[model samples]
Target: MIRLVIIGSGNVAQHLIQAFQKSLVQVVARHPETLHSLPISCPVVTSMNEIADAEVYVLAVSDHAIAALGHEIPGTGKLVVHTSGATGMHVLPKHHRSGVLYPLQTFTKGKPLDYSTIPFCLEADKKEDYLLLEQLARTVSSAIFSIDEQQRLALHLAAVFVCNFTNHLYQLGADLCAEHGVSFEVLKPLILETAAKVQTLTPTQAQTGPALRGDTATLERHQSMLTQPYPKEIYQLLTQSIIDHVQKL
Candidate 1:
């Protein structure tokens, strides 16, 4: 049985704690409150000093907290890894074997996720440690990737554009709907269909809108109808970008 110690108290840490609980892995966390929402059966402590020695210590803390936490954890040659996508492995303490076990999926506290669909991006300085990470990742997920720091950084950037930015657009759409006294629920089906279409169709192939068709009159009307300056500017910018992109194709 691989004994695992996870540090920090956030969405990623909590989600990881929950996932490992169902596996044969022994999980221990430095911060217990993070697991408050989770019905975890393992040990959870309040301090790093109270943490038990384990085969792997996963630093699931924030990007800024990583280097500081790495300094605090006693390595003793045990495998210590972080669950960061942007931060590189060099930020980890060199006294011990350092690695990365970044789960390439958005995590929400108290929200259940299908672990099998989430990819685990693994990286380690040593070959043995890499294999160990692979074994640990396999416990909860089948989608595993051996992505290095450079590749992970690129992937992280792409995720920001696809996930975070797109979600922001959804929020904007919701707000627009609310302003027009239309229930956001009305857009749910369209949103689902748009997302489902990407499963088999390329984003470019699935594209449909006034901008894609180069309907200048509709685009101008949309820009003019936007009561707010920011939204109107955004609409013009995005519409022009789409038109420019389509022209290249």
Candidate 2:
């Protein structure tokens, strides 16, 4: 079995520990107490010096801390990988074999995830290292892709628009519902249907709303109903965007 020494105790690290429990030899964290919540059997070390010999060192820390943390690892020969979407593989210690093992999904601590469905984006400095990364990735997830640094960064940008922005819109909708004395539950079916539609239809094809239909009167009334400047501004911007997209189509 290919042993892994995961460094960090954050959301990505915890999830990875669960997924690779069988191969996980040890977990290195600055605060060992942060890992107490996890239900893993692997030994947890507070220092990098205590990290056991392993085939791969998985740095599941923040993007900013990756380079500094990479320097602390004991050896230069071991394969070191980080779970950052925005960071490039070159940020890791130049002496060690560097790679990226970014998972293309939003991670919330304590939330259950099916590892098989989560896409694992892999990159490495050497072909053999990439193959080894792929071998490790396949152990947990079947949805693996060999993406380069630029492509990975682009994908991360797209993910923010689709996931983060969409969730914010949902929160805005919930707030609007609460303000008007309506149950947000009423919109649940519509939300689920809209999501389901995009599975088979392209986003453009799935598009529907007063803005998409060019219903100026309805759009005006909706805009007038929004008292808050922020929501109103967002609505106007999105309405104009939808109109522009339709005009381009």
Candidate 3:
């Protein structure tokens, strides 16, 4: 069994704790309320002093907290890893063997994740340690990758563009729909279809609409319909981007 201790109680931490609850896993949180927030039934404690011996220590705290909170872990030569996409693995305390085990997925509080489908990006200081981390990752996920710190940083940036930025655009779409007295639900099908198309076709290949066709009349019509400055700016920017992209193609 892969014995491990998870530090932190945020969305990522709670999800990890839940995913490995059936395995040999323990949890340590700095705040008792954070631990209580989850319906976890593991060996949970709120003090670093109460941390038990484990083969691995997974830090699932925020990016800024990883470096500072890492000091709290006892550096007993145990393998340590953080669950961050953007932070470097070197941020962990030097006393312990450190690595990165970033799950390249957006996490939501109190939501269950499909562990089998989630991709786990792992990195370790030693080749043998990499295998160990892989073994633990395999228990929860099938899609495991050996990603170095630099490559992981690049992937994190891409994730922000595709996930975070795209989600913000989704919010903008909903707001626009609301302004027109249309239910956001009416756009759900188009949104899902757009997402589904990318699975089978490259985004460039799946591209359509007035922007792709360089229909200036339709583009102007869209811009004129948007009375809000932000939406108007975004529409013009994206429409121009699409046209520019197609021109390159």
Which pairs clash inside model 1?
A: none
Error of 1 at 96 (Å): 0.6
Candidate rank order under lDDT: 2, 3, 1
Error of 1 at 237 (Å): 1.2
Q: Per-residue CA lDDT of candidate 3, range 70-121, in tens? A: 7888756788899998888788888888889999998887777798889999
Q: What does the lDDT come to for candidate 2?
A: 0.93
Error of 3 at 117 (Å): 0.7
lDDT, candidate 1, 24-45, per-residue tens: 2434455565567777776667
lDDT for predicted candidate 3 compared with the true structure:
0.86
Error of 3 at 84 (Å): 1.0
* Model 2 per-residue lDDT tens digits across residues 101-162: 99999888888999988899999999999999999999999999999999999999999998
Cα-lDDT of candidate 1: 0.84
RMSD, every candidate, angstroms: 1.8, 1.2, 1.5
- Candidate 3: deviation at residue 173, Å? 1.2
| Candidate 3: worst-modelled 10 consecutive residues by lDDT | 32-41
TM, every model? 0.93, 0.96, 0.94
In order, the Cα lDDT scores of the candidates are 0.84, 0.93, 0.86
Model 3 stretches astray by more than 4 angstroms? 37-39
